[model samples]
Target: MILKTFGWSFVITAVGLALAVLYDGWTAFGIVAILSILEISLSFDNAVVNAGILKKMNAFWQKIFLTIGVLIAVFGMRLVFPVVIVAISAKIGPIEAVNLALNEKEHYKELVTDAHASIAAFGGMFLLMIFLDFIFEDRDIQWLRWIERPLAKLGKVDMLSVAIALGVLLVSSMTFATHAHLHGGAHADKGETVLISGIAGLITYMIVGGLSGYFEDKLEEEEEAELEAEEAAKKSGKGGASAVLLAGKAAFFMFLYLEVLDASFSFDGVIGAFAITNDIVLMALGLGIGAMYVRSLTVYLVRQGTLDDYVYLEHGAHYAIGALAVILLVTIQYEINEVITGLVGVVLIAWSFWSSVRRNKRIAAEGGGDFSEKAEVSTGV
Candidate 1:
């Protein structure tokens, strides 16, 4: 199972290194490997969050997520999306944008930096919504219930998210528009326009994200109903076909929600990666490798039952997400490096792992007496 899971990753790595060798030999290979490792380390929390969703999906969709979903994440979002962003930002044609990246590497950084403000805006708002939803929504778990009642009284986080996003847009627009005379550039007006554009993106994300959440809840309800019906049918010796069909449908919608969640997570990673390198091929190769590792890590989490074993892990990831969202929002007013964002996630996830281990040890020690009692009783039997 492990080999099957990682086989495609190895193939991708081999192909990436082979291409790197053809282009710039061992040095390029090393760079790609290093970048891939860096990306993987930074995205550990992403895998955990993904696992929570992936566990709800059926086997077939899980395969699709590993294959087609990886393609979209690594190639479509990481590679093509950056290029498209560059083209728009630089006010150049696609070919010219490629040429600019290849020839004018130094100037490309400025374009990337300019692009960050807007991308950060969208990423920030989206993540804020995620954090708010998690904190506000009622989960079956007890420890998490404390915040739910208070958050629920405040109303839907989605509504608050929309209002906050619009406020950000209005503030950014006012700043840019008012200060237009203070800063002169090739596209001064374009700078002001980004604020409005970013708000539109945020609104779109809100609509999609909210609808996805609603659908997910509805699916869960339907699955519960089906399960109850199935239980009744088995007791009465009746048909179970309808229940099975409902289960399949529930899994399908769960899969869709997982993909949407993945896309949201990728938005920041994809945009942040452009800061490191503008070469679409290299970006795709590097982030693809990272995406592969994250997928493997997710499967490992499921197999290991990491969340069930380590209670604090999810809480830490959500906290980190919230922090990242705030950082991204602040970047609209002040620049924060992508390295910093990546490092923040790495540190948070590392801390969570350590905390999980500590927690498990404590649990084991506390259960030691019970185990001894059971051993004595068994021996008597």
Candidate 2:
């Protein structure tokens, strides 16, 4: 299973390293290797979140995610997205942006860094909405009961998630974004830009996430109908039929949501890549390889039923996402080290994993009679 899951990633790693060596010898190769590892470390929580979503998708859609989705992630976001941002922000054509990236690498990096405020505002708000929605929803499993339970109660209010997300956007735009340095220490009030970008982000999340949910509900209804028919057929001595899977509009919208979520997660890593090297080709190779591994890991977790085994893993990933969203907003004014961003996610996930292990041991020692299920219903955090 591991080989089948990670085979493509291993192939991509070999090819990417070869290309890096051919690009500028061993130094470029080493840089690419480091960037790949950095991306993987920063994105471990992403794999967990992705697994939770991908498991709901059908086999065909899962293949689409591995193939078409991979192209969009590696080239569209990792490569083309930055260029598009530079083109728009620097007021230049796409070709000029490409030339600037290749020739004036330092200048290109500066443009990308200067554009960070807008990027942070957009990605931050989008990610914040995701975290808010997750935490606000009432669930049988509460990872942090003290906070999550109250939030869940308040979540009964209409549009609470959207209201809180918009409030955060407004506060950040007025405060942190106003003091942000643009164009390499040239201070300017970025409040207007931040507000506009944040609104766009919030609107994007609403449209995409809303449509996905609607379609997913339809898919669920279809699945239930199929299950009913199959059960009836079985009782009547007819052969059981296969359950319907996510497809059509449902699958497409879900796929779209996944890609956008991936883009939100990649914002920090794409910008942070500049700190390592400004070579566009090298960055694409490195980050692309890392992305493949993440997708592979997602598939592994889903196939192995890791989420069911360690239910708190999903909770951990969401908490990490919340930390990242706050960090992105904070970075609008203060420069946060990439190391801190990466470590915060790793630490939270590690703690959750430990909690899950403890829970499992306690269940076994107590002669488990659905104690795990019972524990999920308990008010303890």
Candidate 3:
């Protein structure tokens, strides 16, 4: 299963490095390798979140995610996205943006960096909404009971998640966003840009997440009906209906949400890659390899039922996302090291894994057959 999962990632890594070496020298190769590791480390939690969503999808959609989705991640976000940001921010044509990226790399980096306020506002708010929704929803399982339980009770309030997210955006705009740290040297009035971008992010989440949830509820209902029908048919000595799989609009919207989630995660990686290297081709190759591995890992976790085993893994990932969202918002006014961002996620996930292991041990000592199975049943997995 390991080879089946990561085989293509290995192939891509080898080819990407070889191309990098051929592109310039050992220097280019080193940069590409570093960028790849950077992307993977920063996105580890993202892979966990993605797996939770991907498991609901059927095999065909999963294939589409691994193939067509990788293209968008690599070319669309890693390469062209920076260029587009530069083009619009600098008021230059696409051809000019491309030329600036290739020939005038430093200037291009400055332009991209100048646009960081809007980028951070959008991505941060989108991720904040995800974290808010996760914590706000009442569930059978609670990893951090002290914190999560109260939040769940508050979740009963109508639009609590949206209200909190908007409040945070407002506070950020009034305080951090007004600071003159972004946009090449010192500048003000960034609050307006941040506010608008944050709202756009909120609206986007409402649209994509709303549609996905609506269809997912429908799919769940259909699956339940099919299960009931199957049980009845079996009692009468007849064939049962096959299990329902996620497809049609449900699958499409879910895929869209995943892509948007990826984009939000990639915002930091994209902006940070400029700190490592200015070559767009190398950035794409390296980030592309890391993205392929993330997709592979998502599939591995789903197929191997890792989440079912480590029940709190999703909780940890969401917590990491919440931390990242705050960090992104903070970074609008202050410089944050990428290492700090990566370590925060790793630490949270590690702690969650430890907690899960301890829980399993305690259950085993109590003579429970399998805590994982018990957890699955409790959560309706």
Candidate 4:
């Protein structure tokens, strides 16, 4: 399974590097290599989150995620998305944007960097909600009992996650807005820009998340009806509820969920890439390498049943995500070092992996089967 999952990723990396060398020689290749590593370091937590959602999807959809979805990740995002953003932001045509990217890379990079505040706000808020929901929900296992226990109780408040997020956004916007005016930088009204951008982020979260939850509820109702019918048939010794995931809005929403999630995660990588190199092609090739590996890792986690085996892994990933979200928000005004960003996530996930290993030993010693099965039952795996 590991080979089958990562084999193509290695091939993609080889091809990307070869193309990089041919296009702009070894200098470009080096930049691509750095960008790829940067992307991987920043987004390992994203893979874990993707795995948790991917396991719920049917095999066909999963294939789409790995194949069709990858094109979107590599080209649509790494290549085209930046062009679109630049074209719109600079009030130029797509042709002009492409020229800008190729002929005047520094100016193009500046435009992209200038857009960072809004990008950070949108991505940060979406991810913040994901973390908040996980932390606030009632769970069978509590990794950090003292903290999570209280947060779960606080979850009972209606729209608690959204409320808390808004409050945080409010505080951040005010503090930064005040700071921007006092600092007297290039942006004259950055405070207002930050505020509006943040509200846009909240609205986006509401629409996408609401649609996802609504369809999921409908899917659950249909499943319950099928289960009831299955129970009746079982009384007469017949087969059980259907396990197949058909093509429909529910599946479509799941796809949307993943795509948007990926786009949000891409914001930091895109902006950070400017810091490394201003060449768009090099940035794309490098980030593409990291993206392919992340997709492969997502499939690996799902097929290997890693989530089930490492019970606290998802918790750790989400916690890391929560931290990343806050860091992105903070970066709106300050220039944070990428090294610090990567290390925090690595530490949290490593800690969780260690905890899960210890947990498995305890469960085995107590004469229980793999805790993965129990985690599945609790998590609807």
Report, for every candidate in turn, its global Cα lDDT versus the true structure.
0.65, 0.88, 0.88, 0.83
lDDT of 1: 0.65
What are the per-residue Cα lDDT tens digits for candidate 2 across 1-381? 988989999999999999999999999999999889888888999999989989988888889999999999999989999999999989999999999989999999999988899999999999999999999999988777888889999999999999999999999998998898665667668899899999999999999999999989988887888789889998897865454445578888989999999999999899889889999999999999988998899889999888887778888899999999999998888888889999999998887777777777777787775533655643323
Mind giving the per-residue lDDT tens digits that candidate 1 earns over 1-381? 777777888888888878877877777777678668767766777888878777767677778878878877777766666667779866889888777767786576567656665666566666666666666655443233445446655655446655765675566556543333211132333345556556655775666665655666767777787788889899999865354455565566555556655655666666566556656566677777888888877877876677776555676677678787777656554546767877888776667667656655654776643221221101010
Ranking by TM-score: 2, 3, 4, 1
Candidate 1 to truth, TM: 0.79
* Positional deviation of residue 118's Cα in model 4 after best superposition, in angstroms: 0.9
**Highest TM-score, which number?**
2
TM-scores for all predictions: 0.79, 0.95, 0.94, 0.91
Instruction: Give lDDT: candidate 4, residue 32.
Output: 90
Runs off by more than 4 Å, candidate 3:
232-246, 375-381
lDDT of 3 by residue, 20-41 (tens): 9999999999999999999999
Native-vs-model 3 lDDT?
Answer: 0.88
Candidate 1 minimal-lDDT segment of 10 residues: 372-381
Evaluated against the true structure, the overall lDDT of model 2 is: 0.88
